[model samples]
Target chain A: MKAEVVVIGSGISGLTAAALLAKKGKRVVILEQNRRPGGALKRFTRRGIPFDIGFHYSGGMGKGEILRALWKYIGVWPRLAVLPFPEEGNENLRIMDSGKVVRAFFSYDRLEDELQRVFPGEKQGIYAYLNKIREISNTIPFFNLDLPLTPYLHDLFSPKGMSLAQLLMSLIRDTDLHAVLSTPVFLYGVPPREVNLTIHASVAHPLYSGVYAIDGGGQAIVDAFLATLAEAGVDILTGQKVESVLIRGNQVAGVKTSEKEIYASHVIYTGHPTSLLDLVPGEIFRKAFCNRMRNLINTDSMFIVFGAIDDPDTLGDLTWINYYNIRTGLDIMDLDLRHPEKSIMINAPGRRDSDSTGASGGVLLIRMSVWDEVARFDQGVREKRSAAYRKWKAESADKMIEQAGRLWGDAYSRIEPLAIGTPLTFRDKLGLPMGATYGVRHSMNQFSPGVRTRLPGLWLSGQGTLMAGIMGASLAGMVTVGEIEGLEPLWYEVRQCR
Target chain B: MISDEQVYQQVTQIMAEEFELEPESLQPDATLYEDLGLDSLDAVDMVVALEKAFGMKMTDEEAVRSVRTLADLFDLVCRLKNRQVTKE
Candidate 1:
């Protein structure tokens, strides 16, 4: 069926664009490759307990905060089940050298007081650092996914003037606090030095503002978007992977999937833009843009292990823990595969869940650093290598189980049906180029793709776009929607919602 | 010097306090999960709390791969602290 808009991939970006368009009374159809919606923002059931595969915790849930504001306008906030991280000992930063644990609480006053207690003389530095982050976060355009892109920063003193790493370094003297402040760097899985200060501000500024995890797991967020689209009368087809974007003359006519062909006026892809290149070549659009796509460096994918335990309360209530074993500083370009012991961040959602069922029923999340492709494994013989891969996965799971068992005592044995996702899994299942979790890494020289591409009526939105996380993807969606509808009028309506 | 049961008693108390398990219910050979029900996150917290209570520390990596039973944790603490006493 022909529709005004077709959103490929029911991830955050696709959901945002589709829901917004549908809300605006546009005929929209969303195509999701998975049987379920919510691409990376997903949840799975293990041992009858729902565990969030993606979106362990999120920032910016306070009343007027950027992400919360955007989500509230979209009717997502009201239905979302959100629980804040603990007031104290919420964000702990560990120094590998002294074994000193510095905790950053949700309360700004408490965080400041704790910093003073830990580093008596560094109070001034801490104040300046927090202020700089707050200021920088507020100035960046599309910070809330509602701002215009017109004012491309020529003003050097503006919030967009400095990179995130630069602003952070300017504020702190101690090396560990800087690393701790950038602890969330692993969330995007990029080095702190590479992350734009504006991105840091947008993420961190909201947390003191407030952070929350959806109680029903990541699926609730996806379901909310689905409900919004349904209410708007948008058709959604799951398990329909789009094979190609059918271009007619100079315009995007429609898309073809494994089972069916669907026609639409515009196709907005939520996956990596380059993935679309094979289906709809750059030669079809602009040759220069194709070269740009080929040249762009995709962000590193991750290896996540989800474990279900009966008693989650055994572990202290810490929403998330960013563990770095690296003794030195932070650098994205210096990610070394040979060095596996650097830092491994673990997020225990069961501890974070305010409405957790019981100590025996809570879930623990494991995220460790991994290179995109294990150099030894060959993807060409994947089908035949399934047995070998299973062996390796079991070996890997055993190591994790052994390590985890040390912590949980006998509760480690209770953890069953372990699911391991590698970069190859993302490549094979999600159709990501090189299994990149976030689209393209935003580099100093390289400009990540915008919502609009060179191909007329063809757009790119999602983790790969200029912005990387959920907030970033949603912003890209707004930008794409803005391009279709006049920006000023779009802002007028969105602002009115606030 | 504390007796073997006394050492076990102190260890169990810390484990119970940190992991929210009952001290009386915990046994020296009881697996944290198989018997008393402690998970990885709890294990890490227990190790940290043990260090805080005993004034010695265990790395997260060490806390994970090395820990198994309640007695295994007690041994680690004793070794890290250099308590040169044999188990009963």
Candidate 2:
């Protein structure tokens, strides 16, 4: 196969990059390893209940927002159906031990009001933190959309040294308040102490601005991107794993997949940064550069239970609420990885059929976990795994269900474990090393790999390149494509879309 | 505290290792983009490498963009290191 550009990995980043490039008159081909596209955005059905794997809800979907502008520019906005979260109490943070629940509303004023209502003494600190997030997020060039691009690139590349923990310590004194404020860190899979302040602010500021869920879950997003790509005349080759990036001299010639070789001058790799080392020639990148990619720290993975609630009446308002149940007095920064039950996120993406009298709702029970928990069971593929691994996985799911039942009430006990995903499952399915949930950790301690590499035509995108989450990955695609076709013109076009 | 001479040596060493340039070729006046063949991407990585090597936060955008030669980088490192010491 021959094309002007070959984009490896068909995740949001890859799809976004392909759509944008194809729209700009470049012939693009997307090679995905799995049978289907949409890396994490892909959804599965078990017993007729659909569940989202990676995407749940996102921010910056409001009118005139960056995500909206980007999606509109890429032609996925009109096709997508976004349902905004309720104006009040979109997210509920529950401390299990104290039974204290703090709700976060959509708007800043309402969110502040709710916080002050919950923590009466910490009003001043809450204002400072939210204002800081807004201030920092406004300075981000693309995130702001109105800001000039060149001058702020330096700020994005060289982040401020202060970690989120340090910044929070300077403002807030209450420990529980700290946990509530830092709950958004789970979205990016970084601890508050290690996550950079600017990165955290960027992630949190959007949610504060607005939060919305897609109409049909993550698969809807994949369908929208696939339709847009098809309209743009971009070809998507699934079940083809890119084994190595074919290099001719100093430039990337194309890629060699498991099946065949596709020739193209420009190659965009949106996979994990470390995985790049195995695909490229040993001599292309310097020893230090290669070492940096290899030694890059990964974000923690998760142990997820995908099941359904047959009776929607059991849980009132099943659609809008995202529950973060944390063990009381436990530092939310460090989730107990050894015991997967310590901290859990319960999300119900609404009932399948709101009009049907017998409607069942899909619920995802996610516990943050480390790869070491499932390392012993990582010997084979998903189906071919040993019986011991299956037994361990079933046992782990039972414990998570038990914990969820204790904290979230008996509605969770009725949830049959239709599917369970461990770090091994993530590693095999998403092709991330150690099943690192968000790829490389964007922490204060390390520098994230740049979009451009030592190789002339090979570029990097996706979570590892920039930030994580749907918005972050989409921005990575925009940034990588912008780097190719001058940022000024692209930003100008995106601004016009807004 | 590290002296200016030691800082210069360490900066040059890091540059050589990171960019695969020989230490002998890293002259004080060698241009980063021209003589050393570094691009904009390399400049970003250079800041990260220097920051890690010196154990200091190189968040000064003006200093990073102003750097054109090996001497400029060494000067930036020295200034940043001194700034860290004074803050301490």
**Largest lDDT belongs to which candidate?**
2
Off by over 4 Å in 2: A327-331, A337-341, A350-359, A380-383, B1-17, B27-31, B47-88
Off by over 4 Å in 1: A141-149, A152-161, A318-328, A332-340, A350-355, A359-365, A372-375, A378-385, A401-417, B1-88
User: In order, what fnat does every candidate score?
Assistant: 0.00, 0.46
Residue-level lDDT for A321 in candidate 1: 48
Per-residue lDDT for A125-220 in model 1, tens only?
Answer: 888877777666566654443555555322211212456577667777776666667766655655676666665665667655556777766778
lDDT (Cα, tens digit) per residue for candidate 2, span A173-244: 777778888888889988888887778987898878888888887888999999999988999999997889
Could you give the CAPRI-style class of model 1?
Answer: incorrect
Q: Score candidate 2 by TM-score against the native.
A: 0.92
Residue A305 in candidate 2, Cα distance off native in Å: 0.7
Query: What does chain B score (TM) in every candidate?
Result: 0.73, 0.95
Q: What is the lDDT of candidate 2?
A: 0.83
Error of 1 at A454 (Å): 2.2
